[model samples]
Target: MKMGMRKPSLKKSISARTKGQLTRRIKRTLNPYYGKRGTGWLHPKKKLYNKAYQKTTFSFWDLFK
Candidate 1:
């Protein structure tokens, strides 16, 4: 679990901003459990890691390069 600044990746950041909308739309269309609550149960470990990562890590302006 990374606890401080997140390692930066331009590609990942760019993908996050752009891919979110399209993938969300696709998930909403094709995934039966897209927006349902408690759906994280399907992938508890991944969900837990992401939750921790969000709370514990942050990005620095210079880290992008």
Candidate 2:
């Protein structure tokens, strides 16, 4: 398991910040349970993705970057 900050992906960083807003908005609008409780079961892949993302990513507040 990756125990520290993930290797940066230029494409992921740029596109994640720039694109997919509409998709996010649409998902939130269509699903009342979106981003809320029981999402792990409802979307196991998303849950796993989030778990891995959290483990491997860093925040803006991180001094080391």
Candidate 3:
């Protein structure tokens, strides 16, 4: 009998990636995991990449949206 490969679950795919991205984002925003807090920190080696610019005026409601 021949067996075929099954497609990945859509729900699992989205949730998995979403959780991973959010986790990394939160970790990087906090201290310890992220080394310093200035220009030198963005030297590629110790840079923290985010979806948007580091500096933004995102209010409490705006963050949820």
Candidate 4:
């Protein structure tokens, strides 16, 4: 049989220790603002403002009006 003819397995398995380590790594990466804002702590407000600004220019008009 050719290697190219092999069927892919639909299931993936990982050890519990590996899963725990991955969870720890993710937690460590997210620990800075853990309880305060979760993963979006870095740019939450800026992202919100950018989205709002992109939808309208009324804020600029108010400043110069």
Model 2, position 1: C-alpha lDDT score = 50
* Most TM-score-accurate candidate: 1
RMSD of each: 4.1, 3.4, 13.7, 18.9
Report lDDT (CA) for all predictions.
0.86, 0.74, 0.53, 0.53
Scored by lDDT, model 4 comes in at 0.53
The Cα error of candidate 2 at residue 51, in Å, is 4.3
What is the alpha-carbon RMSD of candidate 1 to the true structure? 4.1
The local distance difference test score of model 2 is 0.74
Candidate with best lDDT: 1
Query: What does the lDDT read for residue 43 in candidate 4?
Result: 83
lDDT by residue (1-65, candidate 2, tens digit) is 55665567778777777676667778899988777876587678887988888877776447565
State which candidate, 1 or 2, has the greater TM-score.
1
Query: Compared with the true structure, what per-residue lDDT tens digits does model 3 show for residues 1-65?
Result: 11233344778768879996887778778856453446455565534333122333233444467
**What are the per-residue Cα lDDT tens digits for candidate 1 across 1-65?**
78998778899888978988789889999988898998987899999998899899887874667
TM-score for candidate 2, residues paired by index = 0.57
Prediction 1 TM-score vs. true: 0.62
lDDT of 1: 0.86
- Using all chains and alpha carbons, the TM-scores for the candidates as numbered come to 0.62, 0.57, 0.28, 0.25
Q: Where in model 4 is the C-alpha error above 4 Å?
A: 1-16, 33-65
lDDT of 4 by residue, 1-65 (tens): 12222233333234445675787678778875543544544688976775565565443234556
